[model samples]
Target: MASVQKETIIDADPADVWAVIGDFIDGPTRMAPGFVTNSRLEEPEVRIVTFADGTVAHERLIARDDQTRRIVYSVVGGTMHPTHDNASMQVFPHSEGRSRFVWIRDMQPDDLAIEVGAGMGHGLSVFKQTMESPR
Candidate 1:
């Protein structure tokens, strides 16, 4: 299995960050607008996400904890078919007006780790830019 973790501190309140990421259905589009072109819920627990690079993924929500500001999901089907793919995003309070955003992805087939990690890195960068921008 390949496990990749990426984290960054955003210059925003934890609650504010949660408000954006907690939506699950629309969070990706909002968090990384250009990177994630569109995201919609196929069902209560299933989401279909379209990326800017023409990659689409059907992700199922595994868990969501409001108190802990964490959301877990798994990609069931998409352009890149993997035996196992699970990911989680969480926000933690940092300083008075900053929050730490952490993203972790675990998947089968170690070779995919590099590509997946690069995507995660780019996504996080866009997310940080979006969150820090004036709203």
Candidate 2:
């Protein structure tokens, strides 16, 4: 199984980042507009997030720890043409004023580094910038 981990430092406070992270359906509401066009919250911690590429993903918020500022999401069920099964994303907070967001898993049909890299790289940057951006 291949693992990809990346980190970025944001100027925003932990709480600020947490707030953005908790946005759930509107996580990208405060992002750099045109990035996350639309996001619809579904039943039972599920959400259908629409991206700029017109790509939509049905994700599930399986776990969330307010005390730890952690959130776990998975794309086991989505609207993608091929759909991503057995995939997940975790967002947690650490440090005085920082957060640790990770996307790790052995989603089937491995060996797609380029595709994964692009998504991860862009997702991290966008999430970081959105969280750090002044309110």
Candidate 3:
């Protein structure tokens, strides 16, 4: 499997970041507003996500740890047909009023890692911008 990891420091409190990202059903759309246009729960552990690019993905929640501020999910069905896809995002306290965001994705077929990584990079940028903006 190919693994891709992306991390960034957000100029926001860890608790604040967790409050947005910890929401499994609405987190993506909330964190990266335009990037993730919409997200709705289909089941207790499953959600349908729609991206700004008009791509849709059916994701299954694997685990969510509020204590650790981490969420794990897998892409069960999506526009991109990957053999396997598992992703996790975690938030950690950084400076006095800042937080660290880390995203890691593991997927089959090394070639797909490039595209996935690029998307992740953009997503992180959007997330950071959103988190730092005034509420």
Which sequence of candidate numbers ranks them by lDDT, best first?
1, 3, 2
**Over 4 Å off, model 1:** none
Residue 100 in model 2: lDDT: 67
Candidate 2 lDDT over 107-135, as tens digits, reads 44456445656766787778777666666
In angstroms, the error of model 1 at 38 is: 0.7
Model 1 lDDT tens row, 1-135 = 999999999999999999989998999999999999999989889999999999999999999999999999999997988899999999999999999999999999888899999999999999999999998
User: Candidate order by TM-score, highest to lowest?
Assistant: 1, 3, 2
Winning candidate number (lDDT): 1
Model 1 / residue 125 / CA error / Å? 0.4
Select the stronger candidate by TM-score from 2 and 3: 3
Query: What pairs collide in candidate 3?
Result: none
- Number of backbone collisions per candidate, in order? 0, 0, 0
Using all chains and alpha carbons, the TM-scores for the candidates as numbered come to: 0.98, 0.75, 0.97
- For candidate 3, the TM-score is 0.97
Range of the 10 consecutive residues with the lowest summed lDDT in candidate 1: 76-85
> Each prediction's Cα RMSD?
0.7, 2.9, 0.8
Q: Of the pair 1 and 2, which is ahead by TM-score?
A: 1
